[model samples]
Target: MINVGLNHFLIVSGILFSLGLYAVVTRKNAVMVLMGIELILNAANINFIAFSKFGNLGLTGQVTALFVIVLAAAEAAIALAIVLNIYKTFNNVNVDEIDHLKD
Candidate 1:
Protein backbone atom coordinates (compact mmCIF):
# COMPACT_ATOMS: atom_id res chain seq x y z
CA MET A 1 0.00 0.00 0.00
CA ILE A 2 1.16 3.50 -0.78
CA ASN A 3 2.10 5.39 2.36
CA VAL A 4 0.06 8.53 2.87
CA GLY A 5 2.03 11.70 2.48
CA LEU A 6 1.73 15.26 1.24
CA ASN A 7 0.27 13.85 -1.92
CA HIS A 8 -2.66 12.51 0.07
CA PHE A 9 -3.36 15.91 1.50
CA LEU A 10 -3.12 17.46 -1.93
CA ILE A 11 -5.52 14.94 -3.33
CA VAL A 12 -8.00 15.58 -0.55
CA SER A 13 -7.71 19.29 -1.05
CA GLY A 14 -8.23 18.87 -4.76
CA ILE A 15 -11.36 16.83 -4.20
CA LEU A 16 -12.66 19.38 -1.74
CA PHE A 17 -11.99 22.21 -4.17
CA SER A 18 -13.79 20.37 -6.91
CA LEU A 19 -16.78 19.76 -4.67
CA GLY A 20 -16.83 23.40 -3.66
CA LEU A 21 -16.69 24.49 -7.26
CA TYR A 22 -19.56 22.23 -8.14
CA ALA A 23 -21.55 23.52 -5.22
CA VAL A 24 -20.98 27.13 -6.20
CA VAL A 25 -21.85 26.46 -9.81
CA THR A 26 -24.93 24.38 -9.22
CA ARG A 27 -26.35 26.08 -6.17
CA LYS A 28 -28.85 28.91 -6.37
CA ASN A 29 -29.18 29.64 -2.67
CA ALA A 30 -26.96 32.25 -1.01
CA VAL A 31 -26.41 30.03 2.02
CA MET A 32 -25.23 27.19 -0.16
CA VAL A 33 -22.73 29.53 -1.77
CA LEU A 34 -21.43 30.43 1.65
CA MET A 35 -21.06 26.76 2.50
CA GLY A 36 -19.07 26.22 -0.68
CA ILE A 37 -16.75 29.08 0.25
CA GLU A 38 -16.26 27.53 3.65
CA LEU A 39 -15.37 24.20 2.10
CA ILE A 40 -12.81 25.87 -0.13
CA LEU A 41 -11.25 27.61 2.83
CA ASN A 42 -11.11 24.34 4.76
CA ALA A 43 -9.38 22.63 1.88
CA ALA A 44 -6.75 25.34 1.82
CA ASN A 45 -6.27 25.01 5.55
CA ILE A 46 -5.75 21.28 5.18
CA ASN A 47 -3.00 21.84 2.64
CA PHE A 48 -1.38 24.42 4.86
CA ILE A 49 -1.27 22.08 7.80
CA ALA A 50 -0.04 19.21 5.69
CA PHE A 51 2.82 21.23 4.29
CA SER A 52 3.68 22.54 7.71
CA LYS A 53 3.91 19.02 9.09
CA PHE A 54 5.50 17.15 6.21
CA GLY A 55 7.43 19.61 4.04
CA ASN A 56 10.30 22.02 4.54
CA LEU A 57 7.96 25.00 4.67
CA GLY A 58 8.56 25.31 8.43
CA LEU A 59 6.16 26.54 11.13
CA THR A 60 4.95 29.65 9.35
CA GLY A 61 2.59 27.65 7.26
CA GLN A 62 0.82 26.33 10.33
CA VAL A 63 0.65 29.78 11.84
CA THR A 64 -0.82 31.13 8.64
CA ALA A 65 -3.33 28.32 8.58
CA LEU A 66 -4.36 29.14 12.15
CA PHE A 67 -4.92 32.74 11.17
CA VAL A 68 -6.87 31.64 8.12
CA ILE A 69 -9.16 29.54 10.29
CA VAL A 70 -9.81 32.39 12.66
CA LEU A 71 -10.44 34.75 9.77
CA ALA A 72 -12.72 32.21 8.19
CA ALA A 73 -14.78 32.07 11.36
CA ALA A 74 -15.02 35.84 11.50
CA GLU A 75 -15.90 35.99 7.84
CA ALA A 76 -18.52 33.32 8.27
CA ALA A 77 -20.16 35.26 11.06
CA ILE A 78 -20.27 38.49 9.08
CA ALA A 79 -21.43 36.79 5.91
CA LEU A 80 -24.18 34.99 7.75
CA ALA A 81 -25.34 38.27 9.24
CA ILE A 82 -25.45 39.80 5.79
CA VAL A 83 -27.36 36.83 4.43
CA LEU A 84 -29.83 37.10 7.25
CA ASN A 85 -30.31 40.76 6.51
CA ILE A 86 -30.86 40.00 2.86
CA TYR A 87 -33.38 37.33 3.71
CA LYS A 88 -35.20 39.74 5.97
CA THR A 89 -35.21 42.42 3.31
CA PHE A 90 -36.27 40.18 0.43
CA ASN A 91 -38.02 37.27 2.15
CA ASN A 92 -36.00 34.92 -0.04
CA VAL A 93 -32.38 33.79 -0.29
CA ASN A 94 -32.13 33.29 -4.00
CA VAL A 95 -28.96 34.82 -5.47
CA ASP A 96 -30.16 35.86 -8.91
CA GLU A 97 -33.02 38.19 -8.03
CA ILE A 98 -31.57 40.76 -5.65
CA ASP A 99 -30.40 43.37 -8.10
CA HIS A 100 -32.98 46.08 -7.43
CA LEU A 101 -30.88 48.41 -5.27
CA LYS A 102 -28.65 49.72 -8.03
CA ASP A 103 -30.51 52.92 -8.79
Candidate 2:
Protein backbone atom coordinates (compact mmCIF):
# COMPACT_ATOMS: atom_id res chain seq x y z
CA MET A 1 0.00 0.00 0.00
CA ILE A 2 1.15 3.51 -0.84
CA ASN A 3 0.65 6.43 1.44
CA VAL A 4 0.30 9.97 0.16
CA GLY A 5 2.11 12.66 2.07
CA LEU A 6 2.46 16.42 2.12
CA ASN A 7 5.37 16.22 -0.27
CA HIS A 8 3.20 14.46 -2.82
CA PHE A 9 0.52 17.10 -2.58
CA LEU A 10 3.10 19.84 -2.81
CA ILE A 11 4.56 18.29 -5.92
CA VAL A 12 1.18 18.14 -7.59
CA SER A 13 0.41 21.70 -6.62
CA GLY A 14 3.75 22.85 -7.96
CA ILE A 15 3.07 21.20 -11.28
CA LEU A 16 -0.37 22.77 -11.48
CA PHE A 17 1.03 26.20 -10.66
CA SER A 18 3.70 25.82 -13.28
CA LEU A 19 1.21 24.79 -15.91
CA GLY A 20 -1.01 27.71 -14.98
CA LEU A 21 1.87 30.12 -15.25
CA TYR A 22 2.78 28.74 -18.65
CA ALA A 23 -0.76 29.07 -19.87
CA VAL A 24 -1.04 32.60 -18.61
CA VAL A 25 2.25 33.60 -20.17
CA THR A 26 1.91 31.81 -23.50
CA ARG A 27 -1.76 32.09 -24.32
CA LYS A 28 -2.91 35.08 -26.32
CA ASN A 29 -6.60 34.60 -25.73
CA ALA A 30 -8.19 36.31 -22.75
CA VAL A 31 -10.32 33.26 -21.89
CA MET A 32 -7.29 30.98 -21.82
CA VAL A 33 -5.56 33.43 -19.54
CA LEU A 34 -8.55 33.37 -17.21
CA MET A 35 -8.48 29.57 -17.20
CA GLY A 36 -4.84 29.70 -16.26
CA ILE A 37 -5.64 32.07 -13.43
CA GLU A 38 -8.22 29.58 -12.19
CA LEU A 39 -5.64 26.80 -12.32
CA ILE A 40 -3.26 28.88 -10.27
CA LEU A 41 -6.01 29.59 -7.76
CA ASN A 42 -6.78 25.87 -7.57
CA ALA A 43 -3.12 25.13 -6.95
CA ALA A 44 -3.14 27.55 -4.06
CA ASN A 45 -6.27 25.92 -2.70
CA ILE A 46 -4.63 22.50 -2.89
CA ASN A 47 -1.64 23.80 -0.99
CA PHE A 48 -3.82 25.38 1.65
CA ILE A 49 -5.76 22.19 2.25
CA ALA A 50 -2.69 19.98 2.18
CA PHE A 51 -0.79 22.11 4.63
CA SER A 52 -3.78 22.41 6.89
CA LYS A 53 -4.11 18.63 6.97
CA PHE A 54 -0.43 18.00 7.54
CA GLY A 55 0.07 20.79 10.00
CA ASN A 56 -1.81 21.39 13.24
CA LEU A 57 -4.05 24.07 11.80
CA GLY A 58 -7.36 22.32 12.36
CA LEU A 59 -10.03 23.47 9.88
CA THR A 60 -8.48 26.83 9.16
CA GLY A 61 -6.93 25.60 5.95
CA GLN A 62 -10.20 24.15 4.73
CA VAL A 63 -12.02 27.35 5.53
CA THR A 64 -9.38 29.36 3.76
CA ALA A 65 -9.68 27.15 0.73
CA LEU A 66 -13.43 27.64 0.69
CA PHE A 67 -12.98 31.39 0.82
CA VAL A 68 -10.49 31.17 -2.00
CA ILE A 69 -12.94 29.19 -4.09
CA VAL A 70 -15.62 31.78 -3.51
CA LEU A 71 -13.26 34.58 -4.43
CA ALA A 72 -12.16 32.74 -7.56
CA ALA A 73 -15.75 32.28 -8.63
CA ALA A 74 -16.48 35.93 -8.16
CA GLU A 75 -13.31 36.91 -9.93
CA ALA A 76 -14.15 34.70 -12.86
CA ALA A 77 -17.60 36.16 -13.12
CA ILE A 78 -16.34 39.73 -13.14
CA ALA A 79 -13.43 39.01 -15.42
CA LEU A 80 -15.62 37.21 -17.92
CA ALA A 81 -18.06 40.08 -17.94
CA ILE A 82 -15.23 42.53 -18.60
CA VAL A 83 -13.88 40.30 -21.32
CA LEU A 84 -17.29 40.05 -22.90
CA ASN A 85 -17.58 43.80 -22.90
CA ILE A 86 -14.14 44.11 -24.40
CA TYR A 87 -15.04 41.65 -27.11
CA LYS A 88 -18.24 43.44 -27.88
CA THR A 89 -16.42 46.70 -28.20
CA PHE A 90 -13.39 45.48 -30.12
CA ASN A 91 -14.73 42.36 -31.83
CA ASN A 92 -11.66 40.51 -30.54
CA VAL A 93 -10.62 38.89 -27.29
CA ASN A 94 -6.92 38.66 -27.95
CA VAL A 95 -4.93 40.19 -25.14
CA ASP A 96 -2.11 41.30 -27.38
CA GLU A 97 -4.41 42.97 -29.86
CA ILE A 98 -6.48 44.80 -27.28
CA ASP A 99 -3.67 47.04 -26.18
CA HIS A 100 -5.13 50.44 -26.97
CA LEU A 101 -7.56 52.19 -24.69
CA LYS A 102 -9.02 54.26 -27.47
CA ASP A 103 -10.87 52.39 -30.20
Candidate 3:
Protein backbone atom coordinates (compact mmCIF):
# COMPACT_ATOMS: atom_id res chain seq x y z
CA MET A 1 0.00 0.00 0.00
CA ILE A 2 1.20 3.47 -0.92
CA ASN A 3 0.27 6.69 0.77
CA VAL A 4 -0.37 9.61 -1.51
CA GLY A 5 0.53 12.79 0.31
CA LEU A 6 0.42 16.51 -0.37
CA ASN A 7 3.87 16.34 -1.88
CA HIS A 8 2.69 13.88 -4.47
CA PHE A 9 -0.22 16.06 -5.44
CA LEU A 10 2.04 19.08 -5.55
CA ILE A 11 4.40 17.33 -7.90
CA VAL A 12 1.59 16.41 -10.24
CA SER A 13 0.23 19.91 -10.14
CA GLY A 14 3.67 21.32 -10.85
CA ILE A 15 4.05 19.10 -13.88
CA LEU A 16 0.66 20.14 -15.22
CA PHE A 17 1.44 23.80 -14.72
CA SER A 18 4.79 23.46 -16.41
CA LEU A 19 3.29 21.65 -19.38
CA GLY A 20 0.55 24.25 -19.66
CA LEU A 21 3.11 27.05 -19.62
CA TYR A 22 5.17 25.35 -22.24
CA ALA A 23 2.18 24.89 -24.49
CA VAL A 24 1.16 28.47 -24.06
CA VAL A 25 4.64 29.72 -24.80
CA THR A 26 5.56 27.39 -27.64
CA ARG A 27 2.31 26.83 -29.53
CA LYS A 28 1.39 29.17 -32.31
CA ASN A 29 -2.25 28.17 -32.53
CA ALA A 30 -4.74 30.14 -30.49
CA VAL A 31 -6.70 27.02 -29.59
CA MET A 32 -3.59 25.27 -28.31
CA VAL A 33 -2.84 28.29 -26.16
CA LEU A 34 -6.34 28.11 -24.74
CA MET A 35 -5.90 24.44 -24.00
CA GLY A 36 -2.72 25.26 -22.16
CA ILE A 37 -4.56 27.86 -20.11
CA GLU A 38 -7.11 25.22 -19.19
CA LEU A 39 -4.34 22.89 -18.13
CA ILE A 40 -2.90 25.59 -15.87
CA LEU A 41 -6.32 26.15 -14.34
CA ASN A 42 -6.72 22.43 -13.76
CA ALA A 43 -3.34 22.34 -12.07
CA ALA A 44 -4.47 25.11 -9.75
CA ASN A 45 -7.66 23.20 -8.99
CA ILE A 46 -5.61 20.17 -8.08
CA ASN A 47 -3.56 22.24 -5.66
CA PHE A 48 -6.69 23.70 -4.15
CA ILE A 49 -8.26 20.30 -3.63
CA ALA A 50 -5.08 18.79 -2.24
CA PHE A 51 -4.55 21.63 0.23
CA SER A 52 -8.15 21.56 1.31
CA LYS A 53 -7.94 17.84 1.99
CA PHE A 54 -4.56 17.85 3.74
CA GLY A 55 -4.80 21.18 5.53
CA ASN A 56 -8.16 20.41 7.14
CA LEU A 57 -9.90 23.30 5.45
CA GLY A 58 -13.66 22.94 5.25
CA LEU A 59 -15.07 23.18 1.71
CA THR A 60 -12.90 26.16 0.82
CA GLY A 61 -10.77 24.33 -1.72
CA GLN A 62 -13.71 22.64 -3.35
CA VAL A 63 -15.63 25.87 -3.56
CA THR A 64 -12.64 27.68 -5.00
CA ALA A 65 -12.10 24.93 -7.52
CA LEU A 66 -15.73 25.12 -8.60
CA PHE A 67 -15.44 28.85 -9.12
CA VAL A 68 -12.28 28.36 -11.11
CA ILE A 69 -14.03 25.81 -13.29
CA VAL A 70 -16.86 28.19 -13.97
CA LEU A 71 -14.45 30.96 -14.80
CA ALA A 72 -12.48 28.72 -17.08
CA ALA A 73 -15.63 27.71 -18.92
CA ALA A 74 -16.63 31.29 -19.51
CA GLU A 75 -13.15 32.20 -20.57
CA ALA A 76 -13.03 29.36 -23.01
CA ALA A 77 -16.32 30.33 -24.53
CA ILE A 78 -15.33 33.95 -25.09
CA ALA A 79 -11.85 33.10 -26.28
CA LEU A 80 -13.13 30.59 -28.77
CA ALA A 81 -15.63 33.09 -30.06
CA ILE A 82 -12.84 35.58 -30.55
CA VAL A 83 -10.72 33.01 -32.28
CA LEU A 84 -13.54 32.11 -34.62
CA ASN A 85 -14.11 35.72 -35.47
CA ILE A 86 -10.44 36.20 -36.11
CA TYR A 87 -10.41 33.20 -38.36
CA LYS A 88 -13.45 34.43 -40.21
CA THR A 89 -11.84 37.79 -40.77
CA PHE A 90 -8.25 36.81 -41.41
CA ASN A 91 -8.66 33.18 -42.55
CA ASN A 92 -6.10 32.10 -40.03
CA VAL A 93 -6.22 30.82 -36.44
CA ASN A 94 -2.55 30.94 -35.75
CA VAL A 95 -1.77 33.39 -32.98
CA ASP A 96 1.42 34.66 -34.58
CA GLU A 97 -0.05 34.93 -38.06
CA ILE A 98 -3.06 36.98 -37.02
CA ASP A 99 -1.26 39.77 -35.29
CA HIS A 100 -3.03 42.63 -37.00
CA LEU A 101 -6.75 43.07 -36.61
CA LYS A 102 -6.80 45.82 -39.21
CA ASP A 103 -5.33 45.68 -42.67
Candidate 4:
Protein backbone atom coordinates (compact mmCIF):
# COMPACT_ATOMS: atom_id res chain seq x y z
CA MET A 1 0.00 0.00 0.00
CA ILE A 2 1.15 3.54 -0.74
CA ASN A 3 0.19 6.71 1.02
CA VAL A 4 -0.03 10.02 -0.75
CA GLY A 5 0.83 13.19 1.09
CA LEU A 6 1.16 16.92 0.62
CA ASN A 7 4.70 16.44 -0.61
CA HIS A 8 3.47 14.32 -3.47
CA PHE A 9 0.99 16.98 -4.52
CA LEU A 10 3.63 19.66 -4.24
CA ILE A 11 6.01 17.67 -6.37
CA VAL A 12 3.40 17.17 -9.04
CA SER A 13 2.52 20.83 -9.01
CA GLY A 14 6.16 21.79 -9.28
CA ILE A 15 6.63 19.52 -12.28
CA LEU A 16 3.59 20.99 -13.96
CA PHE A 17 4.70 24.52 -13.34
CA SER A 18 8.14 23.81 -14.70
CA LEU A 19 6.75 22.17 -17.81
CA GLY A 20 4.35 25.03 -18.37
CA LEU A 21 7.09 27.56 -18.01
CA TYR A 22 9.24 25.66 -20.44
CA ALA A 23 6.48 25.47 -22.99
CA VAL A 24 5.64 29.14 -22.68
CA VAL A 25 9.24 30.14 -23.09
CA THR A 26 10.34 27.73 -25.78
CA ARG A 27 7.29 27.23 -27.95
CA LYS A 28 6.99 29.40 -31.01
CA ASN A 29 3.36 28.68 -31.74
CA ALA A 30 0.75 30.89 -30.13
CA VAL A 31 -1.55 27.97 -29.29
CA MET A 32 1.22 26.04 -27.60
CA VAL A 33 1.98 29.06 -25.42
CA LEU A 34 -1.63 29.18 -24.34
CA MET A 35 -1.55 25.50 -23.49
CA GLY A 36 1.51 26.12 -21.36
CA ILE A 37 -0.27 28.89 -19.55
CA GLU A 38 -3.13 26.52 -18.84
CA LEU A 39 -0.71 24.02 -17.39
CA ILE A 40 0.66 26.65 -15.03
CA LEU A 41 -2.82 27.54 -13.91
CA ASN A 42 -3.65 23.89 -13.27
CA ALA A 43 -0.53 23.53 -11.15
CA ALA A 44 -1.74 26.40 -9.03
CA ASN A 45 -5.15 24.82 -8.62
CA ILE A 46 -3.59 21.58 -7.48
CA ASN A 47 -1.61 23.44 -4.86
CA PHE A 48 -4.67 25.26 -3.63
CA ILE A 49 -6.74 22.09 -3.35
CA ALA A 50 -3.98 20.15 -1.69
CA PHE A 51 -3.35 22.82 0.90
CA SER A 52 -7.03 23.22 1.57
CA LYS A 53 -7.40 19.53 2.17
CA PHE A 54 -4.35 19.18 4.39
CA GLY A 55 -4.78 22.42 6.30
CA ASN A 56 -8.49 21.95 6.89
CA LEU A 57 -9.33 25.10 5.02
CA GLY A 58 -12.75 23.81 4.09
CA LEU A 59 -14.27 25.17 0.87
CA THR A 60 -11.83 27.99 0.40
CA GLY A 61 -9.43 25.97 -1.69
CA GLN A 62 -12.16 24.35 -3.71
CA VAL A 63 -13.79 27.72 -4.38
CA THR A 64 -10.49 29.22 -5.44
CA ALA A 65 -9.79 26.29 -7.71
CA LEU A 66 -13.20 26.71 -9.31
CA PHE A 67 -12.50 30.36 -9.94
CA VAL A 68 -9.16 29.46 -11.52
CA ILE A 69 -10.91 27.01 -13.82
CA VAL A 70 -13.35 29.67 -14.90
CA LEU A 71 -10.56 32.13 -15.44
CA ALA A 72 -8.56 29.61 -17.44
CA ALA A 73 -11.55 28.89 -19.65
CA ALA A 74 -12.18 32.56 -20.30
CA GLU A 75 -8.53 33.14 -20.97
CA ALA A 76 -8.32 30.26 -23.42
CA ALA A 77 -11.39 31.39 -25.31
CA ILE A 78 -10.22 34.97 -25.66
CA ALA A 79 -6.67 33.98 -26.45
CA LEU A 80 -7.74 31.50 -29.09
CA ALA A 81 -9.96 34.12 -30.63
CA ILE A 82 -7.05 36.51 -30.74
CA VAL A 83 -4.86 33.83 -32.23
CA LEU A 84 -7.45 33.13 -34.87
CA ASN A 85 -7.68 36.76 -35.77
CA ILE A 86 -3.94 36.95 -35.91
CA TYR A 87 -3.87 33.93 -38.13
CA LYS A 88 -6.42 35.54 -40.43
CA THR A 89 -4.54 38.80 -40.55
CA PHE A 90 -0.98 37.45 -40.74
CA ASN A 91 -1.54 33.93 -42.02
CA ASN A 92 0.85 32.72 -39.37
CA VAL A 93 0.32 31.66 -35.77
CA ASN A 94 3.91 31.57 -34.69
CA VAL A 95 4.51 33.96 -31.84
CA ASP A 96 8.09 34.63 -32.85
CA GLU A 97 7.23 35.30 -36.49
CA ILE A 98 4.48 37.80 -35.79
CA ASP A 99 6.51 40.74 -34.72
CA HIS A 100 4.05 43.55 -35.38
CA LEU A 101 0.29 43.69 -35.24
CA LYS A 102 0.23 46.66 -37.62
CA ASP A 103 2.06 47.26 -40.86
| Best model per TM-score | 2
lDDT of 1 by residue, 1-103 (tens): 3998889889999999999988888898999998999999989999889988888878988899989999999999999998898888888888888877532
- Please list the residue runs of candidate 2 whose C-alpha ends up more than 4 Å from where it truly belongs after superposition: none
Q: Which residue pairs clash within candidate 3?
A: none
Q: List model 4 lDDT by residue over 18-89, tens digit each.
A: 999999999999999999999999999999999999999898999999999999999999999999999999
Error of 4 at 7 (Å): 0.7
Sliding window of 10 residues with minimal summed lDDT for model 3: 94-103
RMSD of 2: 1.4
Number of the candidate with higher lDDT, 2 or 3: 2
lDDT of predicted model 2: 0.96
| TM-scores of the models, in the order given | 0.90, 0.96, 0.95, 0.95
Task: Score each candidate by Cα lDDT.
Answer: 0.89, 0.96, 0.95, 0.95
Q: Return the lDDT, model 1, position 22.
A: 88
lDDT-wise, the better of 1 and 4 is: 4
For candidate 2, write residues 10-103 as lDDT tens digits: 9999999999999999999999999999999999999999999999899999999999999999999999999999998999999988888758
The list of candidate 3 runs beyond 4 A from truth reads none
Worst 10 residues of 1 by lDDT: 94-103
The per-residue C-alpha lDDT of model 3 at residue 8 equals 95
Please list all clashing residue pairs in model 2, or write none if there are none. Answer: none
Query: How well is each residue in 1-103 modelled by candidate 3, as lDDT tens digits?
Result: 1687899999999999999999999999999999999999999999999999999998999999999999999999999999898888988888888767676
The alpha-carbon deviation from the true structure for residue 81 of candidate 2, after best TM-score superposition, in angstroms, is: 0.6
